[model samples]
Target: MTKYLISFEKGAMDHIPEADWPEVGKAARAVCDEAKDAGVFVFADGLRYDDGDVQHAVVDVDGVVTDGPYPESKELIGGVLIVDVPMREEALRWAAKTAAACRCAQDVRKFIDGPNNA
Candidate 1:
């Protein structure tokens, strides 16, 4: 099996109306629950970026740490879902569900199979 990460960029849902957030949350959670029931969900969580608790940092090869996420980065990851599936097609299908539920675009990428990835 291969592990895939399905995620969305920060602020991808900024266009969603405030009042609709609750429904969006419900829809997203339902998708997660479905994945869990299917035994493909490895992990899922929304980053607490809006709450001021989430911070970013950057480290270089010299071990110098700087306030995170290079200034050039236009976006940060807002949420993450990891799934273990037999093929990339299944991962893409799951990402589609996530995008619809979250009202945002989703990206899917496979993890390298190794101790670091596992």
Candidate 2:
């Protein structure tokens, strides 16, 4: 099996009204359930939007530690789903479902040297 990451960027769903979130959540959860039923769901999670809710731990080559999110990009991962599947097409299908449920674009990529490949 190959592991794939399906993710969306922060603020991707900002245009969605707060009132519609419950429905969206329901839709997304349905997809998650589908994945679980298919036995491809490794893990899934949504990140908190509040900056105060985010904390980062960075280790430098010198072993110094820094706290905070990556300074290079304003966008962060909004949510992610990791699936262990046999084919890329299957992963893309799941990503499409996720995109539809989230009402946002999904970025799908395979992990390098995943699992047994190593």
Winner by lDDT: 2
Q: Model 2 segments beyond 4 Å from truth? A: 49-51, 114-118
Tell me which residue pairs clash in candidate 2.
none
Query: What TM-score do all the candidates reach, one by one?
Result: 0.88, 0.87
lDDT of 2: 0.90
Q: Among all windows of ten consecutive residues in candidate 2, which has the lowest summed lDDT?
A: 49-58
Taking every candidate in turn, the Cα RMSD to the unseen true structure, in Å, is 1.9, 2.0
Worst 10 residues of 1 by lDDT: 47-56
The per-model lDDT (C-alpha) reads 0.89, 0.90
Q: Model 1, range 3-118, lDDT digits (tens) per residue?
A: 99999988888999999999999999999999999999999998765456537777879999887544864567899999999999999999999999999999898999899655
Candidate 1 deviant stretches above 4 angstroms: 116-118
